[model samples]
Target: MAEQIIAALEKIVGANQVLRGDRAKPYLTEWRRAFQPVALAVVRPGNTGEVAALVQSCADFDCAVVAQSGNTGLVGGSAASDARRHVIVNLERMDRVREIDADNATMTVEAGCTLADAQQAAADAGLYFPLTLASRDRCRIGGNLATNAGGLNVVRYGNTRDLVLGLEVVLADGRVWHNLSGLRKDNSGFDLNDLFVGSEGALGVVTAAVFKLYDPVVQQVTALFALDAPEQAVALQRRLIAASGHNLTGCELMSRQAVSLACTHIEGCHEPFEVDHDWYLLVDLASSAQGHWLHEVMAQVVEHARRDGLLSDVVIAHDDERAAALWHLRESLPPAQVAEGASIKHDISLPISKLPMFLARALPAVREALPGVRPCPFGHVGDGNLHFNLSKPAGADDETFLAQSETAHTVVHDIVAEMGGSIAAEHGIGRLKVEALSRYKQPVERDMMRAIKAALDPDNRLNPGVIVD
Candidate 1:
């Protein structure tokens, strides 16, 4: 059966494009090396039609089909976590900027195009695609749509789902569904594009997408400030929004531990303040207005926040080079944590109002459970998401600390539940969080999601065991 399926895919994408054995090694490993993939074959489709045919072939063979994009997902969704010998269909060959309608402020791009490529394409046409992630240079647009990724700019431009106007998807049964409309106001029956945006390739394969664009920011200001606590960060956001309005494009917070680790482990990282503080916020404001008004407004907002006790100290950038340097502290955190040692990571979200309390309690509880455990809790505080990660104690056994991963997860998740937060935030529920989703989601909500899955992919051929029972 696997041979017949391979033959059918090879006929569609040529034998050279159908990879197995040594050639399949690259597609089998997750970005974080969390698991090993046991895929039957890695099929590289060049276009939407090829992807459609691959899906149909897998369905006919009664085999599972997993559609992968850049394979940069933190969760096990983008890679085959299970030992299932399913066929892996990756869109690396389908990369292309089909069209960029500058007049309509939209760009049509294939899923294989990297996020950075999409941003550059828009810039060439004097427009801007505002989906900015740390992995933008490597992460593809299709994968961004698949997980609805949120980045530093999400506080203003929103998630990948919000930037998309339409999608060109290949459904479970190999039928191509083309709804690549660029209209901003469509009173259609249902917003079908959204159904697949955050579906994580369970319902279908996102071959291409139509993304909304924005006017490029000509004036900007960035600063790094110290805050006493998470609650103060929230207070600062409120004050800045009131003063700057939509021009405030980015706001990121880092714990003192996260800052210390990043600065020490990652080179070229320097503290922006004269004295160390418990927390730090990286604030940025962008505008299309002319002159130096953007910087002036941001400086004024900082004074207001300080007056309200939301801000303790600040260092505003005087030039573009200085602004980029400030952003380096926030972007280099994840790699620094990895450099420290083996760690348990969580992509979770909570109400901004409860940010301070959740951190205040959860940090102490985890430290108590595993003495000397280093917790680096930081992320998009304005958007209510935190990358709550824990490093093993000094000179501890790696295998033993990882062995208690479940216990640590439970402790953190319990705190999240008490604060009415979600265990999975920007990251979707791939195989990694399927069990957690079942435990946290309401019974009715779970049933409804499963029903939709059953209706769309009746035979469960498309990325099975993800987001459903």
Candidate 2:
């Protein structure tokens, strides 16, 4: 049966495109190397029609299909775990920039195109894509859309879902739903494109997207400031918002521990400030208005914050090189933590007003549960999302610390719930968070998700065990 399916896929695409045996080994595991599944073969489709045919073939063969993009996802949403019953459908060959409408401020791009590639295309057209991520050079647009990625520019441009205008998806039955319209406002019923935007391939495989663009920022002012605590950071953010209004583009928080780890472990990194503080914020202001002086505005805001005791120290970027250096510290947190040792990671969000309170309570409880654990909390303070990660104590065994992930997660998640927060903020409920989703998701909401999954992919062939039971 597997052979027959491979033969059919080969006929549709080509023998060279149908990977088997050693060639298919790489597609069997996920990015984190946490989940591995065997598959009969992996198929690389070159076009939407070919993808549709591949899906139809897998359905006819009663085999599960997994859609893969750049394979850079932390969640196990792209690879086949059980090869005997699954076939990997890779979109790497479908990478292409279909069109770019600079006058309309939009771009139509294939799902397999890397995020960096799409951003460059927009930049070359004198526009900005504004979906910047650490893995932008390797992560594909399809995966970004599937996960509804939120990155540095999300404070300004919003997440992948917000930037997307339309999508082309391959349904379970090999039907293509082409709703790739560039309309800014559509009163159409259901808004089907949204259903698949963050579905993690449970409903369909995203093949292409029409994304909204923004005018390039003519002037950007960035600064790094030290705060006494999370409350001070929150206060500064509020003040900046009140002053700059919508011009405030990026606002990220960092702990002293997080900063130290980045500087020590990651190359091309150094401390931005001379005096050490418990917390730091990297703030950016972008303006398109002519004759706008964002630098002066930033300075005024910082002065006010200092007077109010919201800031302990502040340094406005004097040059482009200095500004980039500050950002490097912020972006290096993940890799730095990895180098330190095993980390218990949580990407959570709370109300903007409740952030200080959430941290105040959760921090103590987390320390009590795991004594001497290093709490490295930092993220987008403006958006109320924090990557509150805990690193194992010095001389502690990795296995011993990892074994307490449940206790740490419970302490953090309980505080989040008390503060009316979400457990999973930007990252979707992939296989890693399925159990957590089941625990926290409301009964009605879970039922709705299950019903939608059952209705769309009746056989549960599309990326099984992700976003659904």
What TM-scores do the predictions have? 0.98, 0.97
Task: Give a tens-digit lDDT track for model 2, residues 102-183.
Answer: 8889999999999999999999999988898888888899899889888887777787889889999999999999987788
Candidate 2 off by > 4 Å? none
lDDT of 1 by residue, 271-309 (tens): 778899999999888877777887778878877777778
**Native-to-model Cα distance after best TM-score fit, residue 76 in candidate 2, in Å:** 1.7
Q: List the residue pairs that clash in candidate 1.
A: none
Q: What TM-score, to 2 decimals, does candidate 1 have?
A: 0.98
Query: Looking at model 1, which ten-residue stretch has the lowest summed lDDT?
Result: 76-85
By summed lDDT, which 10 consecutive residues of candidate 2 come out lowest?
Answer: 28-37
What lDDT would each prediction earn against the true structure? 0.88, 0.87
